[model samples]
Target: MFLDRDGTMIDEVGYLDRREDVRWFPWTIDAVRLLNRAGYLVCVVTNQGGIGLGLFDEPFVHGLHAWLDATLHESGAVVDGWFLCPHHPRAVAAEMRGPCACRKPGRGMIDAACARWDIDLTRSWVVGDRDIDVMMAVAVGARGILVRTGHGERDLRKVDLSLPAGTPVVMDLMEATVLILAEGERRT
Candidate 1:
C-alpha cells in the first residue's frame, strides 16, 4: 500500500516546516499497524512542495520523517518506505523549480517505491485525501481510496463528482484500512 503523508497519515498543516507541527490522526498508528500485521508493505508517498517554495529545506523534511518514524515505532507500526517529491512547478528555489515526475499526479515517487519494494501495481493501493492521490493510483493501475480528513471534505466534493463512480471514498485512514483488509480477504 502507498499512503499520502500530509492530510492522509498526518494532519495537514500548510507547508509543514517544523517537526513540532506534526500531528497524527487518532487512528493513524492503529491503521498502519493493521496494514503491517496483514503483510502489507506500507509506503508513504508525499508531495512536499514546501522545499521548492523555500518554505522549508530538505533537512526539515528528513527530520520530520525521522520524527514520524519514531512516533509510529512507539505504537508498533512501521512504514516500509517513504517517497517524497520536493519539486514544484513554480518554485522560488532555483534547484527545485520546474515540473518533476515525483510530484502528485506524477508517478516518479510511486515508480521508485515499486522498484525498491518490488510492488505489483495490480495488487497495490494508493490511499490519500486528495484527487491527485487517487488519480496517481489510477494512473498506475492500482486501487485508490480517498479519506475525508484535512482538505478531504473539500476534495470530497471533487472526488465524488469527478472520479469514477467505483472509486472508494471513506471517512478516514481507519475506514480505509478496514476496506483494504476486507478487499484482500475477498480476493482470497
Candidate 2:
C-alpha cells in the first residue's frame, strides 16, 4: 500500500516539524495493523515542501518519521518504508529548489519505492487525503482511495475530472482498510 503521511496516517498540522506535534488519527494504528495482517507493505509517500520552503529541514522530517515508527512499534505495527520529496518549485535553498519528479503528481517517489521494494504496482493501493495521491496511483495502475480527513473534505471539492472513475472515497483510513480487505477477499 502507498499511504500519505500527513492527513492520511497522521492528523494534518501543516508542516509538522516537531515530534510533539505528531498526532495519529483515531484508529490509525488499528487500520495499519489490519493492512499489515492483510499482507500489505504499507509504504508512506509524502511531499514535504516545508523542507524546501525553509519552514523545516530534512532532519526534522526524518526525526519525526523516526518518532512515528517507534510509536507504531509500540502497537506492534510496522511501516515498511517511507518515501518523501522535500523539493518545491520555488524553494529557498538551491538544492531543494526546482520542480522535481519525486513530488506527488510525479511518479519519482512511487517509482523508486517500487524499484527498491519490488512492489507490484498493479496490485497496490494508494490511500491519501489529496487528489495528487489518487493521481499517483492512477499513473502507476494502482487503485486510489481518497479519505475525507485532513485536507480531504476540502480537496474533494476541488478534485478535477482527471481521476479515474469509481475511485473509492471513505471516511478515514480505518474505513478504507475495511473496503480494501473486503475487495481483496472478493478478488480471491
Candidate 3:
C-alpha cells in the first residue's frame, strides 16, 4: 500500500522540518504492523515543499525518514520505501524547483513505486488524510482511504462532496488496515 506520511503517520504541524517534530498517532504503529503481516509493502509518499522553499534540505528529510524508520522498526513495522517531492510551483525556491510528476494529486511517485517494487497498482491501496491523497489513489487506479487522524478531518472538509463511485473513509489507520485486509481476503 502507498501511504502519505505527514498527516497519516504523524501529527501535522505544518511543514515538518525537524526530526524532533515527529509525533505518531496512538494506533498507527499497530496499523502498520497489521499491513506488514498482511504482506502489503507499506510505502510513504509525501510532499516536502519546505525543502524546495529553503526551509530545509534533502539530507534533513532523509534523516527524518531514517528516524521514522527506526521508530517503526522498534514497533515491528518496516516501511518498504519513501518517495518525496520537494518542489512547489511558486515561491522563493520556485526557481530551484521544477515541475516533476511526483507531486501529490499526480501519480508520478505512485507510478515509480509500482515500477520499482513490481506492485500491482490495480490491487493496491493508498491511505492519507487529504483529498489529494484520494485523487492520487484514483490517478493510480488504486483504492483510497482517508483516515481521521492528523489533518484528515480538516482535509475531509475539502473533498469535492461528490465522489466517483467507490471511495473509502475510515476513522483511522487501524480501521483502514482492517478494511484493506478484509477486502484482500474477499478478492482472494
Candidate 4:
C-alpha cells in the first residue's frame, strides 16, 4: 500500500520540521500494524515543499522519518520505504525550484518505489488526503482512497470533475484500512 505522510498518517501541521511536533492520529499505529500483518508493503510518498522553500533541509525530513519508523517499529508496524519530493515551482533553492516528476501528481516517486520494491501497481492501493495523492495513484494504475482528514475535506470539495468514478471517500486512514482489508479478503 502507498500512503501519504502528512495528513494521512500524521496530523497535518503545516510544514512539520520538528520531531517534537510529530503527532500520530488515533488509528495510525493500529491501521499500519494491520497492513503489515496482512503482508502489504506500506510505503510513504510525500511532497515536502518546505525543503525547497528553505524552511527545512532534507536531513530534517530524514530525521523526522527516522522518528516515525522507530515509533511504528514499537507497534510492530514497518514502513517499507519513504519517497519524498522536495521540489516546488517557487522554491528558494534554484535546484529545487523546478518542475519535478517526483512531486505529487507526478509518477517519479511512485515509479521509483515500484522499481525498488518490486511493487505491483495493478494490485496496489494508495490512501491519501488530497486530490494529487489520488491522481498519483491513478497515474500508476492503482486504486485510491481519499480520507477526510487535514486538507481532505476541503480537497474533496475541489476535486476535479475528471477524477475516476467510484473513487472511495472515507473518514480517515482507519476506515480506509478496514475497507482495503475487507476487499483483500473478498478477493481471496
Given candidate 3, what's the lDDT at residue 165?
A: 65
| Tens-digit lDDT track of model 2 for 1-188 | 99999999999998887788878897999999999999999989999999999988889888888878999999999999888999988898788986788999788888888788888888899999998999999888899999999988998787464657899999999999999999999999
- Candidate 2, residue 58: CA error in Å? 0.5
What are the clash counts of all predictions, listed in order? Answer: 0, 0, 0, 0
Model 2: colliding residue pairs = none
Against the unseen true structure, what C-alpha lDDT does each candidate score? 0.89, 0.90, 0.85, 0.91
Q: Candidate 1 — which pairs collide?
A: none
* Candidate 4: stretches off by over 4 Å: 159-162
Q: lDDT by residue for model 4 over 35-67, one digit each (tens)?
A: 999999999999999999999999999988998
Give stretches of model 2 more than 4 Å off. Answer: 159-161
At residue 67, candidate 3 shows an lDDT of 85
Q: List model 1 lDDT by residue over 70-157, tens digit each.
A: 8999989999887889898789867688577888888898899877777889999999999899889988999899989978889877
Better of 2 and 4 by TM-score: 4
Error of 3 at 111 (Å): 1.8
Displacement of residue 127 (Cα, Å) in model 3 is 0.3
What TM-score, to 2 decimals, does candidate 1 have?
0.96
Candidate 1 residue runs with Cα over 4 Å from true position: 159-161
